[model samples]
Target chain A: MSPPLADLSAPPAIRPSLAARLAARSGALTGSTAGLALGHAQANLAVLPAVYAADFLRFCQANPKPCPLLGVSEVGAWTIPSLGDDLDLRSDIPGYRIWRDGELVAEVDDASAFWRDDLVAFAIGCSYSFEEGLIAEDIPIRHIEEDVRVPMYRTSIDCTPAGVFSGRMVVSMRPLRPPHAIRAVQISSRYPAVHGAPVHLGLPHLIGIADLARPDYGDPVTVKDDEIPVFWACGVTPQSVIASARPSFAITHKPGTMLVTDRRNSDYAVI
Target chain B: MSPPLADLSAPPAIRPSLAARLAARSGALTGSTAGLALGHAQANLAVLPAVYAADFLRFCQANPKPCPLLGVSEVGAWTIPSLGDDLDLRSDIPGYRIWRDGELVAEVDDASAFWRDDLVAFAIGCSYSFEEGLIAEDIPIRHIEEDVRVPMYRTSIDCTPAGVFSGRMVVSMRPLRPPHAIRAVQISSRYPAVHGAPVHLGLPHLIGIADLARPDYGDPVTVKDDEIPVFWACGVTPQSVIASARPSFAITHKPGTMLVTDRRNSDYAVI
Candidate 1:
């Protein structure tokens, strides 16, 4: 019916991220979703029992830079129509990390079997959206060039506590030349739904990152001598909070494996 | 027809910048313009003969970051109506530096004696506009806090050559913490007419500045250990170029004493 896909060699950006979403829906995309949807906004998935949804929502509202909410599903609902027409929350993400009592218990491609009637899913904005914004302006993204996950660090900056949700803020790093770093701030500031501009830059130890190579989450990428590390409040921050809050049952997209959304990245751009 | 002025003890920002402009016109204010008119856009004056105006205009166009043009008067004209209703080129600035063949020959309170029929006055955008924007956002300005001139440096970064105008870029430094640095970029980027965003930050040595303590122009303020220096392309670049190109006769505002225009800083903001 679809003419068997006309151009397989076209760049991922040229093809809609819907292709990645469809592949994920079929259990074919079982790994990272970093470059798969270059143009569309991707989302970090967070699922928790309905009992914890209100406080988690309050946490997101309190710490907007780290937990910018893209959408939240009704209890037990798998689809958020505003994000996509065909998005199935339980099976759409490439991978999911199941947590119990603050410990990661399982990693799975399909989350359908673990779904409960009281489950509530939140689609948090991802840095991948702003990464696309940076790349559009010809600012180099080091982690993307190195073909690795963006380096994320747990910082000494604490998130504002909301009921039971609280933890240190997590940040994603991108090393850019000074001019590009300034330009990146301008470009990323337009997409506040994602992490927004950078939270910290230049001084790493001041934010409690002792060594550049040792990242708390995601792989370490090359930070050239000529470049200064610019940091954005990361989506992984919610995951860190979940671990700290020790919710009885929770789930999240595996680091770097995001929910490829139908929404264009520009949808979240304020101006 | 106007009522008597009230609240002299109130902050200078409470009064319109026109107050400062009128003071300069009346010979009542003849020192640095800093902190005099806080919310207005001030300008750097560059008066040159018609023979060199075209090349200098090209230089401003070529290197907009360093020499953002606010208004260029008609050849031999002293008034830029767009910048102010009653701005006079000769006596409206606190001090003027008279240059002869690239040498500083005289410092005068008024340049009416030096006005020539072939002279063209160029009003370049000053960082004071963006500084007001930064201060409005509650970001502290270090130089203003210490009551000293902002530190300026000549960078190794070369300007795009335009005929007889060619020289290194000059930049002004403002030290801020990491979060404020990112915010400053966003705030300043909106005021493209006034140096736009910072050209460099973090590593000063990379831009050829050997010591932060010794600036090429202005006084250095204390850069706290927690703060990193953010650099903006400065209005001083045009004066530096005048020295390098050695235009036979030129007139410019003394470093800190700018042409305080009636125009509000918001007039220069893009969005």
Candidate 2:
């Protein structure tokens, strides 16, 4: 019964604690964070030069639902106190994508060699925060159940721009039946620190998504006839903005992979 | 450019305080309580003889989202202290529909003539609690905007039957674009004392709703091409149960007319 996509996904193995997961990333484990570090917060990383940090912070704050800011590392310092101890942003993510002049220049396992004193790192919350809550509620996340990346799409809904950062919002997609989607929206709303609730659903065309089969980013999952695509503002949005608003140099976690942190997702839930 | 319906509705006059609303109802100034006693709790009334009261209470407890029990009057007593000190089951609601053998026999302005010591009253929370929340958030409710009764439908989703009480769930619908629907889910989830979250959305067929244009109950709201019908469990569900349960003697508030209490809607919000 093995499908042709068998090589496309890895197993849901026993994950390390937040600290161990970060340490693994620090070493040479270049991969996604889908099923790793089960109970802790995993964030989308975007490190920009000090010059554009203020504008980017405003962009994140203005679009809180899509770009929920979880932690911001001190300028020139690689550590964020609230995230973890001994957490060096430069080398803790599974991989880093370095962008220069609005193009990806290279993908690397460690960013310590690229660290600059004037660089500031921003950790925005991801849907993984509420995925834990969803799983705890016994709702099956389709992509997670099938062992694939959550589909991501670029939408017509525009994000309020700040400084050099401005672009359409990017969203992650999940497929669920009517009742489950209703429950998902209710459960996800409690974690506003994550991408809370959905931005678009059912009628994807209204949001300018031309094809669900071909996502703008991430691997596509099967959509059942009875199910509708539910979209959440994605963490990839900041990365997309970094690509579009290319500074002289910028660093972000490779898509799918994230910065696993010491903080628990429950700490950020509003209900 | 005002329509005939608008002119008729415009003279609802000054919105009354809770005290004024209660006094009007008690004095047989019978009318729909919608938009009256703003910010106060308006409830769905269900009165049954004491012999079947405990089993009916179990039915409500089993289905809290649809039949949120606000308060229950003591056997033969007219007042429910938790809902209001002056609350009278027989006359506190502007209008009442008397049922015999599950068939509506007649409507009455005041039930004081029919009041008996054996009758017990149950006050159930209403979706009006969350409507205030939605309005506060600037999300437009279609029926409220159109000044029509909120559209309700009898769905195939069944409520757990207790004793002689059993029937399909009744859902009140409001049409909104996908994003607003998501926000409604979050806002309504805060008021579990009302019908919390939603029973269904997007695909009405999944819930046995074959047509949206002709609802079994309430006026049809205009669903724009870009809008989707979002459904919430309605307090009318108990009324639907009465229809199927075929109780020999039962009384309910006439649709649109409700019992207004001193308790603020905010008092029932969980978060």
Candidate 3:
């Protein structure tokens, strides 16, 4: 049987800058940014009122693998000039999930209407950057190969708590043969800002995942008989923590939709 | 109780250069170079007849975690200038263990007496470099604190085979609390030329180590109630493989007594 189509379309002639992309989004560009902006960094977004920002920053620092901080906007400011020339936190991301008292109130294209002067925006390093590295190395990503979302699970491993933010680590899984898995470890080790290497491999149940077919988050992909499941700490972790913490107000990028930044993925590579 | 004395001592005024140190050996150094040449790299030595050198090189390449190659000498050549000026493989190391058909035949200060025109020397990176890094980070090493050798064990994990060299990996263990273990992973990861990050952690039995108190090599240090055993692939693995390969002739540095080179440990740090 033919393999499923990957979102691997050729780059458009007018490669947009971070500002151009954000400007183009009349509302928010609510589509998956998987293969867009090939060489640039994409970020997971989290906006919280200034009151919870300090605790959230501490949370990211303590749980780096899951919530590697890329950039942080000042309270009452939507611009992170270091991340982009004129990035606007309210409308740059393709979509935003607005939460009130830990309950999802709405999924909106633009968060400008809901933005408060006391809000602080956190831009986090995303796994999509490392996936590019993996593809460049010719290691097959099962989900991309099958055209499905990478499988994610809520693991028994608990994140180090910081103030009111604490929850089980949510991990994304990919199945690969042992050799590829080893190579993946070496490649991923170069990008610590993007989750680094696998937290666990080979056994899923050991991390409390009962079934490979039933992931707690994204859709499951095929796991061949000869392959082992490799799990990486996912950026979804902060969202999970925010949910549990039941913050009075919180804003996050919708699943799979991220903020494209001017910074290149290579900027995050350590070696 | 006062902490046990570290091997730290003032460097002798002579402050011998790599060449001077080798010249002064008279025979081989025959003593642990642990606290000497504070910043220089120390290497584990392995010399084999030219007939088996190619296969051994391949083996090191395939299983880098256990045998990270720092330098390899040309057949019959005594020097690896990249590692140190005028390095004489046969006499630069403090001591050598001569093996004939897999059995250790003798321990000599120098292997110059057994040096053949067909012999090739390999210098493998040692853990001592990363130990310097760990110490610099203020991470307490239990064995170092207790003035005992680090414990080591043979694990069930097999090394990737190349030619006739194949065996279970030998690992050195350090017991540390969870927080320190996490920090160690981040620190050691910067020095891939050494063993790099740990191969296994937490549960010892999971890696086939039946008893933490009974080490296969080196003296077992205390494992505290809150600590977990962290294991790194050891340079001893190649020596173990040499024993099993039963090469017609082999020469290796005596355990703990390595060849000091001009390269600094910091030179191997990736970031």
Top of the candidates by TM-score: 1
- Provide the global lDDT of candidate 2 against the true structure: 0.86
Kindly list the per-residue Cα lDDT of model 3 for residues A40-148, writing each as its tens digit.
8889999999999999999999999999999999889988988887678788877889999889999988889999999999999989999999999899999899888
Worst 10 residues of 1 chain A by lDDT: A10-19
| Model 2: docking quality category | medium
Question: Of the pair 1 and 2, which is ahead by lDDT?
Answer: 1
- The order of the candidates by TM-score, greatest first, is 1, 2, 3
Best by DockQ: 1
Tell me the tens digit of each residue's lDDT in model 1 across A1-271. 6568678687666346667878987988888887776678899989999999999999999999999999999999987888886788888898999999999999999888898999999999999898888887888898889888889999999999998999999999999989899989989999999989899999999999999899999889998888999999999998999998999999899988899888899999999
**Residue B106 miss distance in model 2 (angstroms):** 1.3
True contacts kept of each: 0.78, 0.83, 0.00
**Which regions of candidate 2 fall more than 4 Å away from where they truly are?**
A1-15, A18-28, B1-28
TM-score of chain B of each: 0.93, 0.91, 0.92
**Sliding window of 10 residues with minimal summed lDDT for model 2 chain A:** A13-22
Please give, for residues B1-271, the per-residue lDDT of candidate 1 as tens digits. Answer: 8998998987666346677877877889899987777777899999999999999999999999999998999988999998887778898998999999999999998889999999999999999888988888899999999989999999999999999999999999999999999999999999999999999999999899989999999998999988999999999999999999999999999999999887788888899
DockQ rank order? 1, 2, 3
